[model samples]
Target: MTEGFLSSEEYDEQAHRLYDVGDYDGALEMLKEGLALYPNAVELCVGLGYARLAREEFAWARRAFERAMVLDPAHEDAMVGMGEALLRLGHRIEALRLFHRVEQMGFDDDIELMLTMGRALYRDGLYTQARDVFGRAVAARPDSAEAVASLGYALHRLGDDVGSGRQVRRALRIDPDLHEARIYLGHLLYDRGDWEGSLREFERVPPVEHWDALAVWRILELKRALWHMESGDARLAPWEDRLRALEELDDPIDRLLAEIESEVAEKDGLALDPSQLELFSGRAEGGREHRVRSPDGHVYRGSWSAIVRQMRDAAGFGHEPLSAFMRRMAERWHEQSGVDVPFRDPEVFLRAAVEYRLMFLEDGPD
Candidate 1:
């Protein structure tokens, strides 16, 4: 009975069962033998292609699936398999054409095909098109946070920053554990110079019990960098003990401090005045304006006025006369417009303000 000749149907059924059970090697062997007896069997070719795909032999899989498509052009599985193989081979346009063919054949239920097309569009930087495809995916499955996040990322790439922010926030509202959305939001805030807001957003991420430690370390490093920039201090002694407490961090804050120190050294070496180091020491009180030639041969005026204002405010000057002046200006602006201007950290605000005043003196306000 074991040696009995099996019919084509029996062989095909056995091949499919073997494939279903993840025995790709066994399935390939059986299909190879079966194909010899039925050389033109399209199903057998598809089975062989699937076995090749399971084994990650994408080129071989493409050849087998193309043969299956040639034998039976209307074979949906063969078309999808060929498209996937082409996509893996980086023939994105050809793969999208095949996917479009699949769609034209009334296979709208193919969520995997849609996702593949969307990803291809994303890689090509056709983000608006990608967003449309991802929108369809969301419509098909409203509860999919992955789809929502993908759409949000597409929108962000397309320069719809506000829309992207809203989409990511919506994803977070739907699923608070969506780490990607949280990180993207943090990045948007940081780019806008909302350092405190960005820090608050980043801190919402829980400890990395199962998440990637590198991501957490990067966020913490960014926070420390912002703090150093605002405080104009590099000693790190005050935060040294707290940094040690974060033993689980893969790359410690001390490493980040060392990198910052190296960067300061490189930049400081190019400075014209050594005494100007006092500006970064948090001791300077007045803004300094300078005309410097940019590396691109562009002559531009740069000012460090904001740094002076920050130093003045931080030097135990509680409600000083300058503070009142700034308050009056802020209040006057608020009275003219309903929107309140965002106040930077004392040091940063002062530095930027002083720099602006110097620029006004040299270039005049535009």
Candidate 2:
């Protein structure tokens, strides 16, 4: 069929397929073409909004969402898109209000809507809120493996490791193909010192299916420790290649940030603890008065661990254990920048986090 003869719904569907494959540019072009032909098409506007969002163009996303909302005030997807855009734009309260509006408009039982809002909350580090929404999604669709897995993730972030494990296991039972949940379960087991069990989970996921560098790293570490595999072993080649590919896919800005942090650390004689090579860790502390500036320019002052705690509290993560909070931050850094932050050591973690733009070192309070 010719593109010129496609209906608005067909255009929206084509754009959605492109978006799902991470082709935001193509999705944007398709959406723009559709919008030009059918300016009043609410679905096309919502698709445009999501495509813009995937590109990190929050203001444009909001405008697209606003246009969709004006055309159909009760559009659920449009409201969710606007809420996400607002969250990215630092308008948390308004974003939340829009989510609530969706529920108030009688979409509370909508499993997809609930999951969408829950994931937005999860991405913003609002674990408590995400947990609640995911719970609702699970209730609405008891057989939905994705909803159950999402709830599991939220529970994990909230420091409920036992609950998280159970929910994630249940999700896997519902759909064994849920590799993301399986990978998460592996990390959770690794965190609990269950190396054999962790390796079992990691091995179930084929190296080709792994997207996150952390998982590939863990798989390699586990194989080395459990099987006594040498680094040059033929069995390890695919995983090593996968890790390299994942690392290479990191954002250029993040690479620049890592380079800058590396230079600063080298010049200042800061060295990462050799024991801190892995992702998870126990904890550490210091007594010196340390001050750090967050991305928003707010300064947190105290010892190294204390500064992280203060930042955690400010970010509404005080409810979780300090170690868990640090590990969460470190995991996020790895996922974003493909660089590991040493969660066991506060100083090292903070130093590494500068590359992820999570925090920066500042002079001690005078």
Q: What lDDT does the true structure give each of the candidates?
A: 0.60, 0.79
User: How far off is residue 120 in model 1, in Å?
Assistant: 3.3
lDDT of 1 by residue, 230-296 (tens): 3334533333333333332322222443465567778855654664343343323233343332222
Best by TM-score: 2
Clashing pairs in 2: none
Off by over 4 Å in 1: 1-58, 67-78, 87-90, 207-214, 225-366
| TM-score of candidate 2 relative to the true fold | 0.71
Name the regions of candidate 2 deviating beyond 4 angstroms. Answer: 1-3, 254-366
List RMSD in Å for every model shown: 18.5, 11.2
Candidate 2 displacement at residue 263 in angstroms: 22
Q: Relative to the unseen true structure, what is the C-alpha lDDT of residue 290 in candidate 2, on a scale of 0 to 100? A: 62
Q: Quickly count the clashes in candidate 1.
A: 10
